[model samples]
Target: MLNFLKKKAALIWAGNHVKKTQDFKLNAEIKQEEQLLMMVRTAEKTLFGRQHHFEDIHSIEDFQERVPVTDYEGLRAFIEKMKKGQRNILWTDTPLYFAKTSGTTSGSKYIPISKEGMPFQLAGAQSALFHYIAKKGNADFVNGKMIFLQGSPELEEVYGIKTGRLSGIVAHHIPSYLQKNRLPSWETNMIDDWEAKVNQIAVETEKENMTLISGIPPWLIMYFEKLIERNGKKITQLFPNLQLIVTGGVNYEPYREKMNELLGGKVDIIQTFPASEGFFAFQDDYLQEGLLLLTNHGIFYEFIPLEEYGKPNASRLTLKDVELHKDYALILTTNSGLWGYSIGDVVRFISKNPHRIMVSGRTKHYTSAFGEHVIAFEVEEALKSTVAELAAQITEFHLAPQVNPTEGLPYHEWFVEFEKEPEDLNLFSLKLDDEMRKRNTYYDDLITGNVLQPLKITRLSRNAFHEYAKAAGKLGGQNKIPRLANDRTIADILSEYKI
Candidate 1:
């Protein structure tokens, strides 16, 4: 009876959120404009103050001049100030959680995400569901089990009080009645305690009827692999009613085919962009396209032209004025207390009617070693196409840039694992090179000697890269191999055979 009541309450809440989303969609254009003005006013009051630079800033260009660009270093300084109990330049209260992100290029940043700011994040996720339901003509998923494959919820205590990173804190905000009674308890564990927790989840979920699954793609992929290894083809037998699988935190494009094969190709897959800063956006039912922005929520959106980040005359755009099909670096000011924060990911606008966008890749996750800018997404696409053409089954792969001084050409070195060796390795490598040239003009120019040479491919043993990541402490939950390295430093680290 208790479980039934809890499920009922959860359904009611979901219905309310859906209703609100429908109303918002009906008034999207007007609401978007209104929200833009309100956000400008908020930015003036918080980020700019009464100074003339902050005032009378009617255009995106003017706003750019008033606020200087900030990276993780600047954010670190702000966090340090708060740690010493000093009045922070941003927020006044002690934050409820500090979300940790993977620090491949630098040390991990502990970003503060407050409790009052959580509702918007939750709403962003819910709105994605609303869009999905509308597209699929099904609203019956409100009562389904949602399994978030998130980090464990344990952290160091301060002043005899317990706190954790943002993901854990948000997990706590999940309505108690909606939570699975049979799942392993996250209230008292740290993410570092993975082995025990993985075992626990494996045991408990064996009997539970899970419907929704969420987590970083790499980790979830590892979990599914473990299940397959342990239970054989009986893995899906555990969750007979599974409907949707949601993944993020890292690129899912590379692992999509493999993941679908593992899950028996029965469930619908969706990707989301939920970060410690806020829930940015999510892929709705239009699974092949972009995510619709939650424009009127507690968050305000801004965009900097990707090519003009450090320029003195760089401009920014609000949600009301951004152009479709143009790539822009994202800057966000949220009710979560992050004012004019640059969260470091770049994205492109896909649609203007519903304010939909797609994450391109991170600002640093690109290779320009030979002046041929190849992003992570593009590389993943090229790999996917190449593998399909070769009829090869790739388990895992990584791309590293190699500069050849003798040839004066820069090329990508692909370390890939396959089920069986292709008949002709050289032909396979050339095919991948041809695919890259076809996809990217820059690579085509590089091949013609205007920029660089053709891309190279080296085959590794099946599960070789996975084993390497496991040995390096990046395997399983939340740890992912770097997809595109901008500099030789990360390249060196990835090239290392040992952890």
Candidate 2:
């Protein structure tokens, strides 16, 4: 009886959500303009606004002209002031919370989360689920237990404001309506050790009615492995009602085959694009190819053509100007007081009517050591194609430039952890190299011109990446290994574990 009641309520909510989404699609441009103006007006009196002439900003053009695009480092001074309990430094009021995330230059980055802007993050996640329910006409998953594998909810005070991992901070804000179905007791979630926590979670939820599981792809693989070990059965066999899997933090295509194998069959999956800055996009239509960009939400976006990025005269484009299939570096000016901030992500639009995008790679996370300029998207697509053709399965992989090789010319090096190694490893390497050259013309040119040799594959021992993460003190929630890097930081460390 309770299950039926929950399903009925979910369906009604989904119906209302669909109508609102339709309205957003029709007025996305206007809403985005309004969002920018409202945020400017709200923060006009703050220090940053006054410094940047926000009060004079009347249009997107004016705002863009007055404010220059910047990364976290540029705003570090104002954020430091806020951390010391300063008010109106960046926003109208002090931040309610600081969502901590790992940074490259700086050890830790604290992103302000305002009370008014935080709801949009939660709403974006709920919108994804509601869209699935509305389109699929199946709310049965809502009636069964749902698990969001996450970091500890325990938080520490940072000058009178709560601070923790984005996933941990979000855990505290789960809606009361879904609390009844949410799994892995609060006690279990608070465990600081990830492996220990997964063990406890497996013991507690294996026998329960788990219908929906949400997590990062790599970590979810760990949880699934634990569950499988406990019962010695496929995930679907253990939880016959399992219906949905929600994933984010990294691209899903690379891990899909292995995850499907673990589950014993394919299951409905929703991909989300979330960061401490904001919940940016999510897969709203299961049939659609890309994530639906949330235009009416708290964020106002700007795009810089990937080729033009870092150039002084680079064009910053608004929604009306974005072209389909062109890669652009994503910028955000949000209700949380972030203005013209480069969040380091690169996205390519797939649909324009109600804008949809695929995260191609990060602005900084690509290899260009030999002027080949190989991005994560190219390598992932190449690997996916090669894997399909060769009937091989991968557990994890990383790529770096082998600039100073012992014998041959400088080449790209791929360290791969294979779940099912191809019968002919040499053939697999050649095929992968051929596929990569097809995707990246510069890489092909380099090889043809004798500037570089074909990429070399270094097969890794099982659980190599897990050990790398563990040694680096990043063995848990939301921490992902970079797919491509110009430096040898990771590649050199991985060398010690080579098979």
Candidate 3:
């Protein structure tokens, strides 16, 4: 009953806060500056009081200028310090939990998400719910149980102290009511029995009335494909009450159309931007094109110009100072003891009044082969267009940069799986290449020999990629098949195609 009341109270508190923020109005610039000041004050209280890194930061400018920008590496060092029971460089007490993230770009980062950080994560989830509510203008459709396709928490012993990743930590914090019976009952140790977990989800979801689903896009896509194959129309026929689908952890644009089709074109979709470090943003309204910054949360924000790299003479902008349409890389100082940390995500301003922004992509998640720069968003858009034109069902896909040594041309190799094989694979590849060029002029010039030839597409056997990810111990729940690769490592992994 206490747990129930806590959840109910939290829901009410979140609902009221969303209403207040949505209704509050101020000059976009003024509002941003105010939020920045609040964030700095909070950071000073939380981070400065706890660590030596910001002990010298006497002012906001002083904090920015003196404190060097940090990434996951710095955070890891901090965690090591905590393990020694020493005072953290930022936090006074030990972190409540460490959020684990797959280190696709760099190495895996274990971010210290504090007890204060839980509110932001919860707010991010609430924002999606509020967006759904605001769109339908009613809560009538949310009656069915929601399923978060998350990693289970059963620990695997390496040295016997209990460690997995951020997913395990987050899973532990889930409202008990949500987990008492609603969560997938598969074993939690992901590395131990991924196949058992996947089989469990397949069997359990088949029996329940799952209305809302959340997870990384690639895994969800594969799960739905598996469901369709197993009990044809079971998704559409069984889950008549399913209404909303929330996804994050990777780009959704590539699989948006395909996902829409799988859901029978009746569900409302909302995208979120969350990381082990922080719960950044969520789509606040169905009509709103981008996510709204969680200003009242325990996170402070700063931005570096996208064009500037390698420590250029760029001034970081607070939320109030950010301009619309300008691309910027994010630097955050959160309550979780990270001070002026660069989370490595890039975002563009969509609005200022309520501080709405779109997650453009990641700094390292880009391809610059042949000098034609292509980020995840652009690639996602191109894939969406290709899916529409081909009228094809994409089971899974990955884009890798390939440089031809003989021709000295750099291009992209697309590894894709479709529901039905195309009659002319070469023609389909050409059409996809043409569409990508059309979407970005930089790609067009590259294809015309200024940089490289057109991209090459390789069709994989049905469910082949899924099987490979499963084999690699990456299948089940939230683990997704990588969608974009900037190097040949992923390409090499997928190259060994044996049916």
Query: Which of the numbered candidates is closest to the native, going by highest lDDT?
Result: 2
TM-score of 3: 0.85
Tens-digit lDDT string for candidate 1 (35-96)? 54555565454322344344676654555566566766756766665555444335535565
lDDT of 2 by residue, 1-499 (tens): 9879989899999999889788787778888999999999999999999999988999998998999999999999999999999999889789988999999787799999999888988998999999999999989998889999998899999899999998888888899988988999999999999999999999989999999999999999999999998899999999999999999999999999999999997679999998899999999888766999999888999999998899997999988999998899999998888999999999999988888999999999999998777888899999999999999999999999999999979999999999999999999999999999999899999999999998899989999999999999889988999999998999999998899
In model 3, how large is the Cα lDDT of residue 108? 55
Number of the top candidate by TM-score? 2
For each candidate in turn, give its C-alpha RMSD to the true structure in angstroms. Answer: 3.7, 0.9, 4.1
For each candidate, what is the lDDT?
Answer: 0.66, 0.92, 0.68
Among all windows of ten consecutive residues in candidate 1, which has the lowest summed lDDT? 45-54
State candidate 2's TM-score. Answer: 0.99
Worst 10 residues of 2 by lDDT: 20-29
Cα lDDT tens digits for candidate 3, 217-282: 777766676677667884667678777778887767767767777777577778888777778888
Q: What is the lDDT of residue 159 in candidate 2?
A: 93
- Candidate 3 backbone collisions, by pair: 32-320, 51-89, 99-166, 100-166
What alpha-carbon RMSD in Å does predicted model 1 have with respect to the real structure?
A: 3.7
